[model samples]
Target chain A: MMKSKHIPEEQLVDYLLGNIGEWDAKQIKAHLYHCKKCQYLLSDWQFLLSQDHKKFQPSQSMKDRIQHSINQMEGKSFKRRTVIGKPGLLFATIACVFLIFYSVHSYYQDINTRNYEIAENDEIPPETIQSAPHTQQIKVTPVSEFNQINGYVWVNRNRNEMLLEVDGLEELINQDYQLWIIYMDNSIDHEILPTQNGMTRMLFRDIDVDEFKKLKASVEPRGGSIEQTGPDTFIVEFQ
Target chain B: MSNDQENIQLLKDIAAGSRQAFDIFYEKYISFVYQIAFSIVHNHAEAEDICHDVFLEVYQKARQYSEEKGSIKAWLAVKTKSRSLDRLRKNKPLLIHRLENLSGSKKMEPGADLQFLHSLEKHLIVEALKAIPIEQREAIIRSYYNGETHNEIAMTMKKPLGSVKSLIRYGLNNLRKQKALMQWVGIDRGEKK
Candidate 1:
């Protein structure tokens, strides 16, 4: 039986260097495939040469700089997670949603009802807006500085009837609230009515809404005027 | 807690995004990591940059670290060495030939099973190198630290290629022997060869 011949230990370095001939390199590779001692020797050389002995001390300032960078990163990441992880943030979000919904609901209710209080026992007009078919609703939003006032005008073009409701105005002595209808042809028609306790509701017949361009309300003298003489309370436009 | 257990816990905390754990980790291993970087890069500013990158990477990739693979110190040392080498390669593209020879010649495991020594005991490695004869020592240092090919080393030393290879083999054998003796005697302090 032929015995396997191990490559000389020193020549293993030559094999690594690629300095050995092709045939010699092939023999070394084959011998190393079966030899543990030769493998350990090769590894020892690799490990030992790869090591460094010189010592160094990094400046304290460098350490501080890196720590500062890390702190900044941590702070930013914490802030990012605060929106999801912090209970206070959840409460703040809920509060913001509630405030927005409340504001929207109040505005809607005020626009729809115009704060017009109808006592339970108050008699409904024989031809009321609710019973009138094909009635178009118009919201009368108060002018600037008259935010406390609100009104609505409902027009039933088919029946030639209209209903006007106003509320939340400051009461004026010896004055009546008046409604003015401006026509598209620039002609104006006016009506005056007494308001008890800052509210008034009136119904009219023989109205043609197709001729109307705008509706405005204002405080006027006791009998009424050909033109407005007091501050405007609310203004609404008809499309 | 044992140092190993503490290090593992620090890694876990760092993975979980604990800045305090990172601070402790930086204090604990910064010196060791910096030493390895400086040894490979051989410049203060460059080494410091390497340390910064390594620490950031460790923070981000802490979850990838497993005690089953290796010690934390070894992981840090390997990271520093790889980063330093990348810097060295970028700075000196001409060294590619030597680097190729280096990679071809020494195919040790990615992170070898050898225990990673701390900075305090680094001088012992210097001592081990010193115990070897001067010719073998020169060949080994030129091949490893200077990134010189064996032929380049042979030309520089005015020695034959065979002699350079022999010197490297002998130098490594001697260094390993000296290291084993030191470990056995428990005399970790550096001493004159």
Candidate 2:
């Protein structure tokens, strides 16, 4: 199964609402950097959300204070531009450099703090479908009559994350269930499905689902196989 | 000139250190900035302080504004919202976390819960929000206003993560459809006239 190439509407909404995790936010930002369609959608959401608030007027004193600050800034900048010679210019340049460095440092610090907060307070459940519109849900059906194992794969291509859940997968003697992710370019990545009570639930991060073409499960040697050298119990192909 | 064009011109003038332009621009958008801050902080004095800080930043950073990025109103909204959230975070470190308790188990249909509804304005955006279910609206507002994440929202709403995501997704989709319908109706009315 393949999803729409565009970033899903729900994802744009998530990004706009700032509900997205750091990794997913980074992925969406990277995509929006090159994608004009998504940029427009994001802008639309921004406009709509911006207007959702009711109007409240500030006191005249607050307005006066802001105006006073603005006037002082304008005066200082004008004086600096007009009166600055070589020494003043050099000093101004140094101040500018320091400001830029401090801004950059503060930005990194903010990001780190936010990441820490998210990690500490917000923990996503493994079964949750992140960005459902971008997720490709594949039903891994039994390939043969003897295979009673049931499995499903959820690949969120945008976030490069996947969730693989299997049920009714009875244990095999002297064998392990190996999961294979077949790539679009004919490359393959395999992982041993560690099961607990006839159920396997695995969440993989940083695995690009766009590269995935097929998912297959096979019974392999006790340690798992280097390749797909076992009988295919379940298989799913992406188009 | 169009409102956006006029605002852009004022921004350009403010960037060039024109106090008159700055005043005009401030007069035009102060209510919007103040309102957004007030909504977030729910305290008039703090919101006023946030507004003062935001306008000062706008004055200093006007040169950095670009119409190619977005409209001036949207840019100011972003500035106001960012500053207001910063104020909220600074004043009460646990206020956002405490907001989770406010998300009660209220099962109300669209238009049934007017508690979250602000003063009804003429904007279709507000109307569109009014048309959405209460839970979804709360999720979106908490996420957007209170800066709560999906997981936080799920916990706050006493729902699963998937359900919270669905609520936001469906809520946004419904708003988008309502906006599109409003635009279509506006065009039809224009043609009729």
Candidate 3:
């Protein structure tokens, strides 16, 4: 008699068809990885299932009926934002709406400031500013010589936050973007700071007015604490 | 459109209250679902009703779709099978009881067992079975589709118990061999493969 621990060859067919339980499923998966014979069997079963496909085409009217039922269910459940509702739910909804509006408004204001700064200085040619979108809230002036670098850094004066946006970055495997804060005193090489949770968005907080003036942005790996600033991803001097 | 992706998008649209996409999606999978039900129920009218009910359940539960779990086809198959089984349980209690009582009936014939083997793709399974030797094919169809136990088959065929076991074992092995040969030749190469 074949040991019960040794799965029967016949069971593999049922296993692949999702007829087996957890323990048997695990055994089959483990066995398949090392056993070419079982793999071949699985491959044959898969072939059989594929051939069976054409023979099972569903009719058009039956499809219509199923879909109609789905539509009715969707209609009943979808609820648009309502003005009159429970107090707590209404308050939470309004707060969410307000926060979204505020974030978008603030973002536009920062972009506007960057544009204005670029126009007044004319230090950077107008071409660089043209690439950045225009907004009515704040003006941004691009520093002329700094535009040579591969990335753009814009400071938000109202929020006291500096935004470093990078483009044309070569994709890195197992590598990520990091940022550092350079102190004005020049006493410290640089205070390694975390910028951008995932290399996409960076936000620097509680800027010392003097230190903020001299800060530059750099890209580093994981926590970005390695060296002060090897080669700057972006450099900006606050006006 | 790729069928799976098209089905997924249709389901998504259905969830978003798009009646047209829902209709198209339903039309695509209904026959496939019906055939599965038919295979289990073995009656056209009842299988059609089961198929309709299965799709209705699918439609009502569109929002519950989780792509991470399994493919739309597998999910649909499972739901259809469960619903089909439920229908069978409810509608065929008397038939099942009768079969249980008649389980001990002597004079089992090979051809009678053959009647149980119906494939959604009838032409293909039939063709494949034809390629195998007659004894092996009969043994396989009896044990598999008919769910006949080895002892039952032995008693029915008036053959020695050991001979019946050998027939089933060797028959399955031969079928497996033929399947491997078909795969090697690249015949019926499709998704299941």
Candidate 4:
């Protein structure tokens, strides 16, 4: 009976480097396939080469910098903001946006309750969009376990028109998703109510994307509230 | 906490929302990853950013990793390479840190593994490596520190695979004898090796 050949160390290196002849490499491969010891040793060798000796850590400042970067990247999808700086613009804009939002929301509610009919004797007045229509696409991700609300947002600049597709959000019976837009400079924010059913097809011409650094959705009671927070809050930043 | 799987386990924990796991995993590999990034980008700040971006991708896209398909090193190496090449062009830098909140996780939560591994008798480990012969030291450093595979180490060292393996095995054995490391990392450190 022929003895199985053990692979030579030089041959193994040669094989790894593609320096061995074809026949020799094939023979080495055949032997290695049958050799469990070689495989284990090889894996250890692989481990050693790839191990971090804790040799050179990026400075602590570097770690903080990197961690901060991770935090920021993570920050984009879901973060809560306090009314930090000047409050005048933030409050005024939210009020105005919500006012328009209520009008549109009430208009839709009345239309639905009236069963989609515009009777000849109906007392409702015709509505007009005061601004030109503009649109921007926005996407969101889950902030935390509770704030898993995520979806698409659309803003029409100048037209004050906005639409939200609350893709992953599950509707709560008494809850609503309030949309908020915050400027990058922390100068102001605009808040509005989005149509439920994933904010689908509702045209809001008031909210502008470029005016905000981030878009937020906070779950609140029906009819909404001044506070932009609740059991769930979601955020996404403009790239 | 064993060979090969420790890193995979760390990543799995990160996916499972273990902030401590993420901390240790980065602690374990940041230097190695940074080395790869620096080697390519040749700029400290850029390399740091590249390293930051790579881990950020790993954490954010953890679900994308199929344990059945790939290893973390390969995933990170690829990400680092890709992100580094991206530096050749223009890309928005990601800022994850709150410059205001620079306090690190120096104070570990009780039962946090990072409590041990964070500092982990760092001086002893460095000293242990220094105690070994330069040949074994270089082999171990490349294999363990730089994360070179056996073949890569051999290519770099101009040595045979068997010799590279022997050098590392011996270096690791000598490193394990450091009582300070034994006390600090505990026995699992050697066992993992």
| Candidate whose DockQ is highest | 2
Return the lDDT, model 4, position B105: 27
A1-239 per-residue lDDT for model 4 (tens digits): 00264443334433554556687667766777778755543443243234343444467787676567566544542334443456668887677667767765554332212111110101111232222245556676667764555566656666545554555556555455665555555443323333322332233333444555666667765434444447546677775
Local accuracy of candidate 1 as per-residue lDDT tens digits, B46-96 = 889888878876775576564543467655655565556545543432223
For model 2, how does the per-residue alpha-carbon lDDT over A1-239 read when each residue is reduced to its tens digit? 01225565545655776656798778888888887766765764554455444545677798788866666543532333233457658878778768777865554343212100000001124235544678878887887753667778787777767777777777676577887777676656665665544667777666656766778888876445545568887887877
Show the lowest summed lDDT stretch of 10 residues, model 3 chain B: B109-118
Residue B93, candidate 1: C-alpha displacement in angstroms = 7.8
> For residues B115-142, what per-residue lDDT tens digits would candidate 3 score against the true structure?
1112212334454567777876777688
The local distance difference test score of model 1 is 0.63
Once fitted onto the true fold, the runs of candidate 3 whose alpha carbons sit more than 4 angstroms away are A1-239, B1-3, B93-193
User: Where is model 1 chain A poorest over a 10-residue stretch in terms of lDDT?
Assistant: A112-121
Each model's TM-score? 0.33, 0.34, 0.31, 0.31
lDDT of 3: 0.48
Worst 10 residues of 2 chain B by lDDT: B113-122
- Per lDDT, the best of the predicted structures is 1
Better lDDT candidate (3, 4):
4
Task: Please give the RMSD to the true structure for each candidate, in Å.
Answer: 36.6, 23.0, 26.3, 24.4
Alpha-carbon local distance difference test for all models: 0.63, 0.62, 0.48, 0.53
Report the C-alpha displacement of residue A133, candidate 1, in angstroms.
77
DockQ for model 1?
A: 0.07
Candidate 2 C-alpha lDDT tens digits along B44-162: 78888878877776765576565543456656765565555444433332232213222231231222222222211123244456788998889888876589999999998999999
